[model samples]
Every structure is written in C-alpha cells, then in structure tokens.
Target: MIFSALSPLLRSSALQNLTQQALLRMDAETAHGATISALKLGLAPQQTHTDPPELRIALCGLDLANPVGMAAGFDKNAEVPRPLAQMGFGMVEIGTVTPRPQAGNPRPRSFRIVEAGGVINRMGFNNEGHDAAYARLKGLRVPAALGVNIGANKDSEDFVADYVLGVKRFADLADYLTVNVSSPNTPGLRNLQADEALRRLLNEVLAARAKARVRVPVFLKIAPDLDETALDAIARVVLATDLDGLIVSNTTITRDTVAGMENANQTGGLSGKPLFNLSTQKLAQTRLRVGDLPIIGVGGIHSPQSAVAKFEAGANAIQLYSALVFGGLDLLDRIKRGLAAAVRAQGKTNVSELSGTQVADWAAGKAEL
Candidate 1:
C-alpha cells in the first residue's frame, strides 16, 4: 500500500495537457481537491530522483534538490507531501495549519481568472489542525526538503499562543517553519505583519522553539502590499531577530495589476502572473534591508524566465503555487530544466550566485518588468 514507487516527472506531454484541461473544467475548489486526492492516491506521474548539481542549494540548514518548492497553500494538510515531492519539487511546504481546525470560508471561496492567468482565493486557512497534520507527518518519507507553514486559528483567543503551539508542535517535525502572518483571508491576520506585533510573535515562536529538543529554522511569510515605510519596519524587525529566512510574499489583496481580468474584483487575495513585479520588487527591497538573511520569493512564477527573475530580484530560493495551478507538475520540471540552463549560461556553478545581482534597481523601484 506504500505509494513510494511512483515517479513525478515521467509523463507524456499529451497526457499532462489533457489532465490540465480536465482540471480546469471543474470549479477551483473542486479542481484543487481532485488534484490533492490524485496525489494522495499516487495517481500522478513520477520523475527520476536525480537533481542537477547546479540547482542544488542550501536553505535553512537543509539541502534542496532544486530551489523550486511546492508552496504552502498547495497541501493544507500533510496528506500527500511525499507524492508532491515525488512530483519533482525540491521542497514541499504543507499547511496554513492552525492550532484548531476550521472550515475556512464558505463554498466558492476560490476563483480562477483564466483570462489573466490569475487566481483569487479567500479560503481562510481551513485545515485539519496541527495534531492531525503532525500525526500524518510523524512517520512520512519524502525525498525533498520539508517545511510547515503555521498560522493562528481564525477564532483563537490569543494569536501568539497559537503560533507558539505550532512552534512547539512542529519544531522537531519540520525541516523549517514558516510563520504565515500575511494571509489576507483571515481577518486581522495581516495586522501581525506590523512591526511590534511581528516582533512579539517571533519572540514567542522562537522562545517556544528554544524549548524544543530539536530547533527548527523559522521563516516569515509576509504580505507584498505593504508601503515602503511598513516594509522598512518589517525588514528591521526581521533583521533584528534570529529568524531563519523570509518568504517575500504570500498573496496580494490589491487588484490594480490585473484590473480588467475576470473575477478581478473578487473579495480575496490575488496571485499568479500579475503579482510578479510588485512581489519581486518587494523581495529585492527586503534584501536591501536585510543583507544576508536568505529569502524565498513566491508569487506569479510560471516560467523559466520568471524563476531566473526571482533570483535576480534577491531571492535565495523560490516557491510556486498559483503557477502550478495553471501549469501542472510539468511546470516544476520545466522550471528546473530552464533554471539550470539559465544559470549555466551565466557561467555560474552555484545557483546562489544569481541572488541579489539587481537588487539596487529593484529596491529603487526602477526595475522594468
């Protein structure tokens, strides 16, 4: 009954294309559920286990097969982490898991804007909670790096206490932990991104981890919609801590970039192609503020060029969610292939060399997308 033998990348283009078309025909939530079910059932195709050395990089004390990771929102629970890793991602992050389970928003909370290659979702971090996810993760085997994105429950009395619980619960379980305070779906979630709130949250989280037998690196996932002043405050707050890294963006609430697209006015966070420039600029700007802390850029990455652009914008690594929603697992393989080619073309041995090269332009808001 072990689904360990399935490889992730060995699929015919025709079959993958057909699968994508079929998924698109369903509603967004339905398509998402079906994809997770397929992965859990081990019905997805596989790829060779080998990762090119050029794309090999270290983040948060873990070696990744590649810089590309399956972003947190992809697997809300720990149901199919192994299957997703088997699908060719260098790392897989599961959950926006809270201390308690919640149903999230009502039905039709997720929407697809096909015309703009964008998605707007207000799923509200619905998950099976830390205990369930921990039980599933306790004995799981996955080939790639593993991370957990932790969040506070929507109805929790004390948000900091919830994050502390996640830190204590997953410090030994995850290769790294991401404090996701930027999600726009949960009311008052983004408030934690403010300087004092973030500082207190991290203090509690790190303190909880400090008591753990095994210390896990804690990364922060932030909102990209912050103004320069707010972003500067966040950068300073993060740089002041011993936090492991940063994921420069969750999803955006603004729709200015994809205004005329279908479902553009939906009441949720916007992700995918339209978020590219703004997110990248924020990543680069954050890099300028925090000199050596590693950052994982996410938002709007769907192509090899976009992957390379993330590195150029000061990311040490990157994560993809919305892009994969549109492109499927094949996109991960193509991105790795394309990234390796781009790195070598620039005569680089280590992919980390590509980080922050154009940060100045991006930080100054002068970088043309």
Candidate 2:
C-alpha cells in the first residue's frame, strides 16, 4: 500500500531499489526468476496506465499508452504480462518462443557486467514452448499491447514450419508477432539474416501472417553485427516482404565497444549501455533503407537521454531488457517520464514528431554494422 499513492518513478525508487539490491545479491538468472515470480504473485507495485499526450503514440497501428516497452527475454514464458504492464511499459513482448519447449543453453547462462552496465546472455531461446505460452497468453490480460517474439527450436527440423506454426498459433493472441532470427545464442540463427536466407524466411513469415486468423502485424528482429552487404540484403527482404515493422539490432557478439571490461570476452550477446550507440546507428541505417516502415528500437537504453536518441534515430517505439536488470522495472516509468519531458522541452506534443528526425546524422557517419 505504500506504493499505491506515489507516481511511478517515486514509487519505483521507494520500492524497486530495495528489491534490486536484494536481487543483485543473488545470481543473475536466480534474480530474474525471483523477479518474475514476484510479479506473478502480484508483489510488484501497480502503476497507473495513464500516459502524457507527448508519450502517446501508435505503433504498427496498436495504440500504446507510451512508447517504452518490455522487450522479449524478460518474461520468456508469458508468465506475468499484466504485472509487467502494471510496472509501466506501454508494450510487453514475451518469449523468443519455439514450437516446442527448450531448456536453453545451461546454468550460468546469464551474467551481469556491472562495470559496463551490460548483460552477457547465452541463454539461447529457452522457453516453455508455443503451447504453454499460447495457453497463458490466451488467458492473459493487460492494459499495454502485447507482442510474441517467436523463434525456431534449437533442434527444430523445419525452421520455416516452426515460424509458420508460431504465427498461426499465437497471431490471434498477440497484438503483433516478432520473428526473431537475431539472437546470437542460438547456433546458426544469425546466419538466417543473410540475403537469400532472409528473403526465404521473411517470405514464409509474411505468408504465415497473411494466413493467420488475426493477421496481426509481423516484425523482424535482426542482429547488430551485420555487415553492410548483409544489411543491404536484409533491407531488400524487408522492403519486399509485407512485414509490419522491425526491432532494430538485437544484442551484439562483439566486445570491441566495451573492450577491456570483465566478462567483456564472454561468449554471449552483450546488451545495455554500450549497445545504445550501435543499435541506434543500426536503427537509423535500417530506417534509411526501409523508408516509412515502423521500427522498435532495442539495445542499451538505460536513461531518458538514450530513449530520446532512439526516437531521433528512427524508432517508432523502443524496448528495454538489460537496462531493467540494472535499473528495475520502474526504469520503464523513468524513461517514459523522461522522454515526455524531453519532448515538451522541444515543444513537441507527440513522440512520433521526433521519430527519425536525426536519421541522416546517425546513418551518415555510422560505421558499417
């Protein structure tokens, strides 16, 4: 009840910081599970769903209360969507789910690099599979928009079939669906981002979406480590495919940017503060290639400044995961409130007004991904 009176930021600071301190005392994966469990038990404080006009925006046609979202991997099993939504995200994306259940890599798969304000995760596409998530999602309700991020089972035989199955199974449940071929932990997953493979994949995904009962929007989440040629190739497929939007640049395999930090050499995708620059640049680059297509920016967003940078770099909206690990769920409220402040400071009424305004600048000098 202590939190039932305060605004999101104040409430979060009053509660989440203490929770985070306790969670931080545990291992990263354990902390994540505990957090999820707490949310499921309704222990997290509820946040008002109201959004300032400046933060209100429609993404791929779904009316979001604000632009900030809970990215996939936070609630991989679709366990606590409403609790997360209550924690203040305008959108909550669950799972990199597959047609069947998977245990992911192994224990110790998630590491927090406090010095770098980053996380190195090789958890693979671990989840309870499509059926479980589908069941929970079907019974789930939330004020925020929900998206299901789907992936191929690590040992899946028919990759395309898995995606098609995911779409057909959950399209009716999700506000939108994300085809994730970007996670570095799944072996050969990123390879699917290549030109020919990407074309074939997106075609199937698009076709699947077309046939789904809901025909919800479909977005492609790509990796940040792509080269120019790979990016150009993926862009062609994005342009050709009737995809709904793109989640620009998943976590990175490269440590060059966060070089010399402990766990910097960890063999997993790195995300958090260091990812902001690369992912934003990649978002700008994608926007340049696929003009007018909506994009959900992810990677390294830990503050209002980074969130504003994401919108300027061309994101229709943005998602955050690793930042939440360090900043807690209330970080979503902080970023949204901060973004609204930034928008008002610029004399803007809606967040969309700033989307892609600085694409030319970031894309111009951005080093090839």
- Candidate with maximal TM-score: 1
Stretches of model 1 off by over 4 angstroms after superposition: 1-18
Q: What lDDT would candidate 1 get against the real structure?
A: 0.84
Model 1 TM-score, all chains together: 0.94
lDDT of each: 0.84, 0.81
Model 2 lDDT, residue 74, Cα: 79
Instruction: Judge candidate 1 at residue 133 and give its lDDT.
Output: 97
Deviation from native of the Cα of residue 182 in model 1, angstroms: 0.1
Location of the lowest summed lDDT over 10 successive residues in candidate 2: 1-10
**Model 2, range 1-369, lDDT digits (tens) per residue?**
001111232234434554545656777777667666556666767775577878888777899888888899878989988887887788999998999999988777877778878888899888899889988888667789999999999898777778889888998899999999999998888888888888888888788778876769998999988877777888887888788889987999888777888778778998888787888888888889888999999988888888888889899999988876667556777888888888888988888998988898878755322
The alpha-carbon lDDT assigned to residue 228 of candidate 1 equals 86
Worst 10 residues of 1 by lDDT: 1-10
